[model samples]
Target chain A: MKTVSLAEMKTGQSGRVKKIYGGRGMVARLQALGLYPGKEVTKLSAFFQKGPVVVEIDRSRVAMGYGRASRIFVEVGE
Target chain B: MKMSPKPKRMVLAGNPNVGKSVLFSQLTGARVVISNYPGTTVEFTRGKLQAKGQAWEVLDAPGTYSLEPTCRAEEVAANLVNSADVVVNVIDATNLERNLYLTSQLLERGVPLVIVLNLIDEAAQKGVKLNVPRLQELLGVPVIPTVAISGRGLPELVAALPKAGRGRGEARSPDERWIWIGSVVKQVQRVTRRRRTWLEALELASIQPLTGIPIAALGLYLVFKVIIGCGQWLEGLLENYFFEPFYLPLLQSLSRFLGDGSFWHGLLIGNLPGGQIHLEESMGLLSTGIYAVFGIVLPYLVMFYLVLGFLEDCGYLPRLAVMSDRMMHRLGLHGFAVIPTLLGFGCNVPAVLAARNLESRRERLIVSAMLAVAVPCAAQMSMIIGLVGRRGGAYLGVIIAMLFLIWVAIGLFLDRVLPGYTPSMIVEIPPYRWPSLKAQAQKLGMRLQHFLTEALPFIFGGILLINLLHLVGVIDLLAGAFAPVFRSLLGLPKEAVSTLLVGFLRKDVAVAMLIPLGLTAKQFVVGATVLATYFPCAAAFAVLVKELGVKDMAFVAGIMLTVSTAAGTALNLLLDTVLPAPMLALFLLGLAVVLIAFCGGSSDRRESRKFTLTKERRV
Candidate 1:
């Protein structure tokens, strides 16, 4: 498994959340919304550079901007 | 059973888009918006259920992921759960792990609870199955599995309602709670991993830039076309059949009965030249008052709500929210704030009410200000189109473009200067489903009923008050006092002052009142601009007061006065020879450059975050 920023992941690629690299407040918020270590999240769509990225996790689609997505580290299983 | 103890106050609690509303409607027989998008309710809704010889009060609060209360809507949800006797916690069966976080919070509240595992149909399709009996035994609550829209398992849900148990809410660490949830899910849930379904594929294609942008544009264009086309067709029918024949003759007869030029006649029928009642110009309670509300505004109000209701019920709104996130970021708002902005064009009252979906008090203030100051509702727009479109489309374009710039500018200013931070949006967009026709019609009818019963009184009462003031010569005195400002500042004649005053009551009527002014194209542009920017209608004003409280309303009022005066005067001076549209557009472009340069104050966001953190610490 190779870990990369969620922002760097291509659309349709699936990964398990490995680490969140952000402020305490933002990290807590993302965690409350179901993005935590070991949970699988698949990228639905990532628009142009710096735009919001859409991801699907456990049957819900969540939208996160690049700034926040970059701080989230995800491991894609090979 | 001692009258069943007033049937127990049952509040349906859940993360947004988990079918709380659908279940609420099924239980209470009250239709509500069931869009898969989060925050469609924005505020809680109450309905009564009479079954099993007990009267039960059912509430459907705005959806929240957890009990921590991030935004105003979540705060509402969290606060509501505190007062309920039995909380019906709706868990999405397919996503049990994520949804259980909120269920765990509800359990900790020590309330008697009924666990509703909703959307079972969708869950089954996704290859997920739950052992409901085992789940119930573990959670120590009565569990009911339901497919809300289809009414599956609803009878069993009612049968199990009386078995709710009050939890001890034993205080435990969040880690322990998570572990407990994981254990429960592992024991009760079976997940079969499978390939993507067609619905999932559609959801994927909806957010990509290349496809999503064009789809959004096409969808929005269709929505507007249907509203405008249906509204105009209804307007034509009302004018020919109802107004010209029935309402007009009755008004003219009332004019003759009171006798033209008499005080009673003038008060009731207004100043009708040649003793004929002019519905639009008469400015009386029975004349323009009823005419404006029922004839002009009602059709557009109905059509807009109907189309909007369909869009909202089918879950198109969240997709729109996703596509607009980048633009919303530049304006310093969460992407979800776009719903209220879209509703603003339909009507400002519901739009202001919808602003509560935003996270902070600062955001609520900014959204309301944006609506009252810049956006024109569809009713107001129709009249503006009727009057302004006659001159040339360019004049009307200038007004709209100017308002859009003001909206962005004010957002930038408030986002910087306000002493709080907007939470970053993490909107949960559910998969789209076909809307039910009966539910859509019921929702649309309910909103239309609200408009007529609530808004018409204010419109008629305002026109009546204006008529009384005019009869008493109070309007003349005020208009005389403000005539200089009205003439030089706004480039309008003094008589137009009354129209501007009536603007505060209803902008639709305000624009209609401008018809008798006979002003130049430039002056009409200035007058309409000031009318829109100065203040919202009486109905919108009351809603803002309720939503923002009196103190914030006063602050918003002060800003409205200052900024509207500046915008109106600026337009008047600039529209001397050439069109002011291009010049104002250029100026706004420069302002955008400056706003982008500073990023609308990065330091301010950090400072506000600190302030909010301190407040939270104190709490």
Candidate 2:
């Protein structure tokens, strides 16, 4: 297993969330969207290198800005 | 004698993108727009439903991920849950696990609940199976599987409503709830792996930058072409067939009957400069006013709404937002601002109201002000196309490009000046679906009805007020007072001042007023651009005042006046003396770059610093 920020995950890579590094509000908002630690997520695509990232979590597609995506630490298997 | 019980309140609650709105419309027979995107219902819509011979007040609340509010729209949804005698918790069957989070929250609230497993057909197509009865037994709530769009399973849904009962209301922490939901899902749900569909491939193509950008460009080009080309064709057909042949003769006889020089004649038929009633110049209630609303504006309004409705329903808007996020971030806004901005082109009133989807007050104010100043509603846009489109395509392009520049400039300026952080975009992107023709027609019908009922009267009143002002010399006095400013800065004749004054009431009418003045093409460009930027029409103005509050609206008004004056003068001088079209285009591009570098630099730095701070804190 390898740990990396969600932004660093390649397209189509699936990961389990390890930790979310942000303020309480950001963390809670992500949590409400079912993006808590231990939840499985797949990076679907990103717009540009630094644009919003699209990910699949709990069978739904969510597009979030790059900065927020970077704060999510995920564990992916090699 | 028994008193009838008061109507029971039933609220539809769900995570974003469930078929709650479609279900609401089916139950109440109300024609609310059903879009395949989150935040479509920014405010709750109330409709009446008669079931079992009892009146029910049904509300479609804004969709939220949880009962605990994360944004304004969710706060609205959360509050409505308290008033609901029975809550219909709509769940997207394809996304059961995530949607069940909200369902669990509602269950914890202990409200009378009915679980609607919506989009069942879609889930079945994706090889998903559920044990409905087992699920019902586990949750202790009546569950109904429905395909709301097709109106299938609706009768069963209505029949099950009376069976609503409070679920297990045990409060659970977030982690605990997910764990419990997992167990329930494990027992009652099964998935069969299947090959990916073509629609899935297309959805993937739409989000990737390489194909998505080109697709976006082509899509926008098609939208404009349809709106402008079809709008003009319809306008010409109406003019050639209905207005010119029938309405003109009818009005001519009325002109004769009222006597040529009578006050009634002037008010209804307007002044005949050469014993001829020109529809564009007449300014009469029956002549220019009617033609402006129905003849010129209605065709374009219909086409704009039709196109906008399709975009909203097909689920392309969120992708557009995603594509534009990088550009939007430069203006301290996320891509979500694109939703309200696009709506502004239809009508600034709804667009201003739609700003509620933004997370912060500062973002709302910036977006609303920018919309007011830059985006031209369909009515005004059609008039501009009708008036200046005759000159050439290049002229129209310049005006559009100029407005785009102004929109960006305002966003960049406000991003720097406003003292608040813009919340980043975190939005769900629903898969593209074939828009229902019935739903599109219903949405178009609702918008047209609003235009006819609300805007038609405003247009007529504005014309009447202009005629009254002209009769009493108020217009002339105002014109004389602003003559030098108009002549020197805008290079417009003194008579054009009346149009600007009328603009505050109705911008399309103001643009139509320019037809009589016979200004040169350059003057027409300046006048139309100024009219669009100077103020929101009275209807939009009232909405902005409500949305932004009196103080911020005043600040917006001040910005509008200053920006319009500067833009008008710049257009006048640049087009007249300094540069030709190509050079002016280059100059505008340079100005944009300089503005971005100057105004956007600080905000970019601040954003990076904040991100780094969060990173360091994590370590």
Candidate 3:
């Protein structure tokens, strides 16, 4: 399946990040944080109205802008 | 810069951060000279003095605690102290007792000593009065009270030097010296108890277990927030306005000319496997590596050093040490571990060496291990925060939680595995005085200059080496060779296999390589964790080899490699099968509970009362 919005991410779940939707230099940064395809990630928390989504993958934790998180699709499972 | 023939040598020795370099600068003027010591790469500064119609060469040795050095700088100071004809023991009079510990050690060594009671004015203003002449008589050395910054007491210090040199020709027992100090103080020194200041009360409150830890946590929280905020702000400016607007286009144009297939093209731009201009993965000189170091790491390190320098100059470090002593003991370290840990925030090499001051071999080993395992040096942290924290603030918390847990857990495990008595911390907490903005700025400038000149070159060279390897297909070979380890053991991609191969050379450069391959969140987390916990940098490895010898260094390296891979693999699989959100969070909460249970029970037991505070007075 193609990547889904990070906002659509389910709590207590796992998925792969398809893309970072927005932020001036965020796409580059998202890549730097290991937010590429074919990698497993678990959603930890989403904050506020349209706030960032926190996720854990590979023993490292990262947060992404909700707008960007939304642009990315994840094949969720478990 | 020319030295006079038969230049009489003078050496400056003092506790770290006591303004010795400032004194050295003032004494020598701007035309002072500096050189490496005879047999060591460590540099020593020498300035010519024309006092008493005799030309004397003054050397500003690095600071140390005692004659026995626990760090490289201290070792250099000890060597200088032994070689010099006249030794100036520059003491910070504010913390008289702890400073005197070093003075006492120097006195035992029988070095020709002239005591520069630096910060005396501050001491007196704070109601600490010293009988200078009585101290001189007691210690059998010349004592002068001068604020080194204002150039006070230089003439008196010069006049008394000849006499002090003669005094050191005779050796005396440390007990005799202590008795002498007692007699001298009895004759001349008088301390009138002043009304307790708010700072004094705060100091007392800060060291008490009930209050101190929360204060420390708050302090750390504030510092981290400020540091992270400043880092992100500066990184935004550099990455967007500075590099993207101007530098990247220029480099991109230059890459076009290099024709992508030429030797310099691949060497400079890195091999764009599909010939795509990968800004993050450009093995080229002008692409990923340069941008990584200059754009990403530089701004953060600059800000970090400034904040740390301000903290150091204000003398809050010693207070923090005292406040954290109890928790540090639980972690199998003394409060002094705070110093090395603080240093590790700047660079791990000195932090590892600074571990020597710990009371036991076990403490040193544990501290050293933790520093290597959990604490990312300024360079690495800059990249991590710049790259990961940018994803979201939550990611910053995640990174912090992961490392903090590792720091605490590894410390606890080592404490259990290695049984040794930890030295009690009786550090003198200097009053919370205002830091001199000018001095702080100057010191910060010097450290930044040192970091740029000495360290940045190594960063570039490491990148260049990786570029060469990528060009020669060596990186691929190594990655393929380690594919089983990465795929099976760590569950990371084969492309990530190369970054880990490069991490040992320099961590920031390795992390920089990640910008190109563009892994998802999972790959990034795994890659960052493995790199952070892996072996020390190339320079640090060399120092460790020298300090620990090849055999012991190998042992440490083996443990680190095994633990790093296992931790990464376990974390990956745990997240996969059983360790979900509540499970991992619950596990962490449970661990904290177990820790509190174990630690509280031990300290609450009857044996704790054996060393109650009433036995000896608190400082």
Q: Candidate 3 docking: what grade? A: incorrect
Q: After superposition, how far is residue B576 of candidate 3 from its true place, in Å?
A: 6.8
Task: State candidate 2's TM-score.
Answer: 0.97
**Roughly what TM-score does model 1 have, to 2 decimal places?**
0.90
Which clashing pairs does model 2 show? Answer: none
What TM-scores do the predictions have?
Answer: 0.90, 0.97, 0.75
Can you tell me which runs of candidate 1 are displaced by over 4 Å?
Answer: A21-25, B5-7, B30-34, B108-110, B166-172, B191-199, B419-421, B549-552, B580-619
- lDDT ranking of the models: 2, 1, 3
Model 1 chain B weakest lDDT span, ten residues long: B596-605
**In candidate 1, what are the lDDT values of residues B1-619, reduced to their tens digit?**
3356566688999988888998999999887766656777778999998768777899998988878876678888989999887789998888898898888777787788899999888888889989999998888899999998889988988887788876668876556667788899999999888898787677767788898899899998898688767877898899999999898988878877888778777666777755567787777778877887778787777888888887887788888888887666666676778899988988888788888777667768888888888988877877776568668767776787678777877788777777656655677777777787877777777777776786677677667777787778988998899999988888898988887777877788788777666789888888888888888888888898998889988988888888889888888887745545556656655665666445654423574456456547644
Error of 1 at B599 (Å): 6.6
The docking quality of candidate 2, as DockQ, is 0.73
Q: What is the TM-score of chain B alone in each candidate?
A: 0.89, 0.97, 0.84
Model 3 complex DockQ against the native: 0.01
Runs of candidate 2 with Cα error greater than 4 angstroms are B1-3, B582-590, B593-601
Q: Select the stronger candidate by TM-score from 1 and 2.
A: 2
Q: Against the true structure, what is every candidate's RMSD?
A: 4.1, 1.7, 18.6
Candidate 1 docking classification = medium
